[model samples]
Target: MSRWSGMPRTTRWVVRVIRPFLQVFTRRDWSGADRLPTGGYVLAPNHLSHLDPFLISHFMVDHGIAPRFLAKDTLMTLPVGGRLLRGTEQIPVYRNTEGAAESLQAAVRAVEAGQVVTIYPEGTLTRDPDAWPMSGRTGAVRVALATGRPLVPMAQWGAQEILWPYSRRLRLLPRKTVRIRIGDPVDLSDLEGRPLTEDLLHEATDRLMDTLTTMLAEVRGELPTRPRLDVRTLEPPRTTYKRLEP
Candidate 1:
């Protein structure tokens, strides 16, 4: 059994409460669960909607993994919700501030301590018109390299159909099918033990994002177009392109 299944009582209770609600609105088509490690690791998933975390956690809990999400600091400050999140031991990220580095450190510590730390590599919802993954930040890579833990890429689709990105309206009439695929752990052996430099982090991050995109293509049964958007550069998606084979 995965050690994370024996999570804190509060987190277990929260999972119990949330699972039923997710089941009511979505059908799960999850695969590659056997690849999940029994020890500490990093989970990197593409961000599609605000609802992605709930959907991902539901999948993880069902498969005997406790997902410790790196969430926005604002969510950690909510009146009632924040208390629950803190009790559940979710990591809060203070983006673009002096405290930002602290979040990455906390994630590294979480992995080193035998917990599943989930970092959305994109850091935010993909701005791609088709919701394909954009260039990712190095937070996930940093956590894995720091702890020498497996960095698992989990690709998901269908949440956007439920709740479109940046929009509050939810479509609940016909239940949506959420497909999740856990790909093989990204291999960073070459970069392991090397000093983390800008070039090294970028290389590692690209390998992860490429694997995630390919896995997502498999789940969607289609190809993804490139050049991938670099959210940091605010690059616009190309109006024309050919799709790459999965």
Candidate 2:
């Protein structure tokens, strides 16, 4: 059984308690939820805020799937936060460190065990000043390809409006509406059995990004004049332990 199978029922109940409050602050409307597989799969969503995981996972809760996320390893050192993450089966990625492979292996095992893994392919929350999705990395692509699982491309908006990235403060003024749209499963069947190459990886990554861009555009009610391809190379900062101390 997955280690997280033991997650206290109260944890989900607690989330439910806060759900209405979140909705009041940022009304949520999710589409294409049917596309999410109840069994093993990967959820690759555009990262915009720290709330992305909780927001997406909330929509996914009723589907008999609990999201196991790829978080920065330093989060594991936090007093209670680390225990909570482990209890929820979140995989920790040690950025720019040797232990990253181990984290990847843990994610693979989770998928193999029929759990959904949600990843922010951009690695960090969007740095797009405007809150657009940053350039994605190949971690999600590699995981999906290696596991042969469907990649559900999720597009989320308004999260940044709720909790601005890299800010010490939250925005309670705007009271924006958060919308999450899940696109159809990205078919990677074409790459199956083919040798994994740089071209293949890039193509797959681009396809995922394209899907996300299209979805986000729909939510924002705007279209891109030109294809923006600036990939952000900055890594996510280590999750600080001090913040978790009581």
- What stretches of model 2 exceed 4 Å from their correct place? 1-10, 13-17, 225-229, 232-246
Clash pairs for candidate 2: none
Q: Tell me the tens digit of each residue's lDDT in model 1 across 84-171.
A: 8998899999998999999989998889889899999999888777889999999999999989999999999999888776666778
**What are the Cα lDDT values of the candidates?**
0.87, 0.75
Model 2 agreement with the true structure over 7-102: per-residue lDDT tens digits: 446456545676676667766677787777767888999987777777776676644566679999999889988877776668999877899878
Give the number of the best model, judged by lDDT: 1
**How far off is residue 106 in model 2, in Å?**
1.1
> What TM-score would you give candidate 1 relative to the actual structure?
0.91
Superposed by TM-score, candidate 1 places the C-alpha of residue 30 at a distance from the truth, in angstroms, of 0.6
* Top-TM-score candidate index: 1
Please give each candidate's TM-score: 0.91, 0.85
